[model samples]
Target: MAEMKTLTAAARSGTGKGAARSVRREGRIPGVIYGGGDAPEPIALDYRELNKLIYAGHFLTTIFELEVDGAKQRVIPRDYQLDPVKDQPLHVDFLRLKAGATLRVDVPVHFINQETCPGIKKGGLLNIVRHSVEMRVPADAIPDAIVADLGKLEINESLHISAVPLPDGCKPTQRDRDFTIASIAPPIAAPEEPGAAAAAAAAGKGGKGAPAAKAAPAAKAAPKPKK
Candidate 1:
C-alpha cells in the first residue's frame, strides 16, 4: 500500500487570478479541496515543500493528510497544472476521501525476475504494453505499484492482468477483458546469407522471382505509316 503523506496548507481568503498571483509571488502554491459533499475549500501550500513531493514522482497516487489551519483532512491529488515555460506548479486540485470511497488511480507497473525468465535468457525482448494500470481502490488500500513477474515467461508469451496478484480491495478499472500487460517477443531476424541474396537477385533477373511480366518486346512499332 502507498504510504500516506503529510502536507501543511493555509486557508485562503482571497480568490481569482490576481489573488493567486499574489500567493505565488510569496512562494506558495494555490490549490483547492472539494468533494465529500462539503463546500470546496481554497488553500495554499509552501512551494518548496510541495515541489519536493511533486518531484518524487508518486504524488498523484499517494494519499495525503492535508493539515489546514490545524485541522487534518484525508485527501488525494485529483489534478494539477504546471507552468508552460518554467515547469513549476501553477495550480492543484485535491479530492476529499470519505469513508468507504473508492478512488480510481493510475498505478505504475514494475517488472521482476528478468534474469531468470526463459525468454530473456533466449534473447527475447520484453515489450511493455501498459506501463501503468488504472485501478479502483478503497482510499485506505491504494497500492504503491502493480508488480508483474516475468520468471516463467517464454518467447512469444504474454503476461496479463489476471496473472498479477492485486492488493486486497484493489481492482483494475478495466473489467471487460483481461488485458495484456507485457510480452516476450522472439529476437529479430538475422541478415540473409550473401549466396541466398545473390541467387534471389539472379532469379528476379530471369523472371522467376519478378513481380511484373516483362513488357512484350515494346510491341514492334507498327510499321510507320507510308509517308
Candidate 2:
C-alpha cells in the first residue's frame, strides 16, 4: 500500500493562457480538478511543492488530498503537461474521487535480486521492456511500485507482467497475453580478432612485395630492349 500525499491549493478566479502564464511567473502551477459529477474547478498550486512531488515520482498514482477553497477533497492526477525544454510542469488535471472508488493508474515497476541472478552473474544484460504497468486498484490500495524478483532467471529468460504479485483487490488491465516486462540476454561478443588481423596485414605486405618484384623484372626487360 502507498501513502497518500496532501497538497494545499487555492481556487483560481482568472482563467486563460495569459492568466496561467502569470500564475507560473508568480512561482505557482495552474491546475484543474474535475469529476464526481461536479464542474471542473480551476486552481493553482505552489510550484515548489508540485516540483517535489514530481521529483519523487509519485504524481501519477499517489492519492492526494487537495485543500481547495477551505475544503479538503480527495483527488488523483489524471493528466499533466510539461515544458519540453525545461521539463517543468505546465498544467495538471485532477480527477475528484469518492470514497471506495476504483481507479486505473500506471505504476512504475521495480526489479529486485539482480546480483543473485545467474544470468547477470554470467555477464548477461538485463533489458527492461516495460517501465510501468497499468492496474485497476482501489484508491486506498494503490501500490507505490510493482516489484519483480529476478533471482532465478537464467540467460534468455524473461519475467512477464503477469508474474508480478498484486495486492488483494488489485488487478492488471492486461489479459489474454503475458506481456514481457524484463529479460536477460547474452552479452555481445567482440567482432575483431587481434591475432587474425595481424596475420592478414603480414600476408598483404608479402603479396605487395611479390608484385613489386615482377614489376622490377619488366622494367629491366624494357631497358634492355631500348639498348
Candidate 3:
C-alpha cells in the first residue's frame, strides 16, 4: 500500500475565474474537494509546497490526510491541470474518501529480476505494453505498484496481466480477457552501413572486368644499339 501523506490548506470563500486568479496572486494554488456525499469546498495550498510534492511523483495515486483550517479530511487527487505555456499547476481536483469505498486508479508496474531474465541475457529486448494498469481498489488500501516477474521469460514470450498476482479484493478493470503487459522480442538484424552494398558490388565488378594491376606492354627489347 502507498504511504499516507499530510498537507495543510486554507479554505477559500469564493469560486470561479476571478477568485482563482486572486488566490494565485496571493502566491498559492486554488483547489477543490468534492465527493463522498458532501458539498465541494474551495481551498488553497502554498505554491512552493505544492510544486515540491508534485515533483515527488505519483501525486494522484498517493492518498493524503488534508488539513483545512483545523479539520482534517481524507482525500486523493482525482485530477489537476497545468498551464500549457508555463507548465505550472493551475488547479487541482481532490476526491474526498469515505469508509468502504473503492476507487479506480492507474497503479505503476514494477519489473523484477530483470538482470537474470532469460530473454534479456540472450540479447532480446523487453517491450513494455503497459507502464501502469487501471484497477478497482479499496480506497483505504491502494497499492503503490504491481509487480511483473521477468526471471523466466524468454524471447518471443509475453507476460500477461494474469501472471501477476493482485492484492486481495483488487481487480483489473478489464475482466473480459487476459491482456499483455510486456513481452520479450527477438533481436533485430542490424542494417548494413550506407552504400556498403553498392561498394561491394562495384569491387566485385572491378575484380572480373578490369585487372587491378596491368603489366606495361613488354617494353620493346632495346633495339639493338649493339646490333
Candidate 4:
C-alpha cells in the first residue's frame, strides 16, 4: 500500500489568472482542494517543495495530508498542469478523501520471476500489453502496484488479469473482459526460418551483399556487321 505523506499550504483569498500569476511570482504554486462535499478551497504551496514532490513519481496515486492554516485534511492529487515550454508546474487540483471512500487510480504493473520462467530461459521475449491498470480501491488502503507472475508463462502464452492476484479491496474498472497484461512472445525469427536473421542484417547494410542486376545482354553487339 502507498503510504500517505504530509504537505503544507497557505490559504489563498485571491482567484483567477491574475491572482495565480501573482502567486507564482511570489515563489508559490497555485492550487485548489475540492470534492468530498465541501466547497473548493484555494491554496498555495511553496514552489520548491511542490516541485520536488511532483517529480518524485506517483504524485497522483499517493495520498497526502494537506495542512492549510494549521488544519490538516486528507487529499490526493487529481491533476496538474505544466508550462508548454519550460515544463514548470502551473496549477494543481486535489480531491478531498472522505472516510471509507473509494478512488479510481492507475496502479503500476510489476512483473516477477523472469529468471525461472521457462519461456524466458528459452529466449522468449516478455511483451507487456499494459503498463498500468485503472482500478477503484479504498482511499486509505491504496495499493502500490499489481503483481504479474511470469514463471508459468511459455512462448506465445499470455498472462491475463485473472491469472494474477489483485490487492484486497481493489477492483479493476475493466470488469467486462479478462484483459491481457503480459505475454511471452516468440522470437522474431524462428529456428525453422533458416538465414532469416542473416538476411535481415544484410538488408540493414543498404543492399551491400545483394547480387547485382545482370548487364542487359549487351544489345546484341550493335546489330550485325555482316549486314
Query: On residues 22-97, what C-alpha lDDT tens digit does candidate 1 reach at each position?
Result: 9999999999999999999999999988888898988998899999999999999999999999999989999999
Candidates by TM-score, descending order: 3, 1, 4, 2
Evaluation by TM-score, superior candidate among 3 and 4:
3
Candidate 3, after superposition: displacement of residue 65 in Å?
1.1
TM-score of each: 0.84, 0.80, 0.85, 0.83
Pick the winner on lDDT between candidates 2 and 4. 4
Q: List the residue pairs that clash in candidate 4.
A: none
Superposition error at 40 for model 2 (Å): 0.7
Superior by lDDT: candidate 3 or candidate 4? 4
Indicate which candidate wins on lDDT.
4
Worst 10 residues of 3 by lDDT: 206-215
Clash totals for all candidate models: 0, 0, 0, 0
Which parts of model 4 have CA positions greater than 4 angstroms off? 190-227
TM value for model 3? 0.85
Better of 2 and 3 by lDDT: 3
Give residue 122's error in model 3 in angstroms. Answer: 1.3
Error of 4 at 1 (Å): 0.9
lDDT values of the candidates? 0.93, 0.88, 0.93, 0.94
TM-score for model 4?
Answer: 0.83
